[model samples]
Target: MMRGVMNRKVPKEILDLFEKYMDNKVRHLNRKDAIHMLRAEFGLDEEQASTMFDTFDKDKNGQMSIWEFQQFYVCMGTQPSNPHSSAQEVVQKFKDIDADGSGKIDVNEAKEGLKTLKTATGRDLDPKEIEFFIETTADDDGQIDLGAFTNLLYRLKLYNAPPPPKDVKLKNPKKD
Candidate 1:
């Protein structure tokens, strides 16, 4: 059993799609930088990005080599240009978060799922903190449904940081 980092293979088609999307949306960036940029821009923490990257980087080389990236590039590139337009995408995301594909995200699932999100957004959420969140937010059913997941994402977007330009400067103005 491969424990630490799962060796899930990202299909070549998907890899190719990811690369194509990157080329069009982030022409100046290398794959690693692009990944980081996308995560930061989207307000995802390092852990989330790492989990996503790990899924695509079957070989676990730390970087998405051209070959590996190409596989994802193809899949993501062909996806509907309006990522939010597809209900299926939301459903799939919900399913992924469920982990067991159980159609319900329990406390553990929610904790783990939020941890992944924190990672993607470069945020640090301690396990105890996550447990607290789950206790407060989860319903009596002990499950977070797809609707809840969407709401959570929407809330998360509210906290997204503004992007900084390449050359950011701060200057003090003369007091009048």
Candidate 2:
């Protein structure tokens, strides 16, 4: 949710990529061109690439500028410049948390899911906050469908945070 920090620094590599593929002198990448670049350069499938383009298009105007890309990396967290994931991966995460094969997550299930997320991400979310998230996303009957859950995760960047760097304590250790 951190947006519009004027002094934030964007990595040169990111800027280079944008500069390389810029379609116009204005240096802005429209949605179609960005999608093509993402698919070609990053090997992302169309859906995955489109998702990333949508994320960076902050103004929701089908165009992405260098500044928007910088803000996206900021929102995605430092160190891991790009945390985009395929829709399949996101669907898997939703299925993992849904439990009981119900295709929907109830309030109680959301609590358990929140605990699992905390364990996985080391993020501490209060039970009430988790409940509120579920309540707000759920239907009048109080059950969140898979689509809603996926959208929530996408917006929150829950499934997009890269794993912590692993410290290789013993370089070239014997293979098992």
Best by TM-score: 2
Model 1 is weakest, by summed lDDT over 10 consecutive residues, at 1-10
Summarize candidate 2's per-residue lDDT along 38-145 as a digit string, tens digits: 676555577656766775677888988878866544443324344344434554666687788786777777778766654235565555546545665677777866
List lDDT for all candidates, in order: 0.52, 0.60
Enumerate residue pairs that collide in model 2. none
Whole-model lDDT, model 1: 0.52
Candidate 2 stretches greater than 4 Å from native: 1-9, 41-43, 77-112, 119-124, 132-176
RMSD of 2: 13.3
Give all candidate RMSDs, comma-separated: 17.9, 13.3
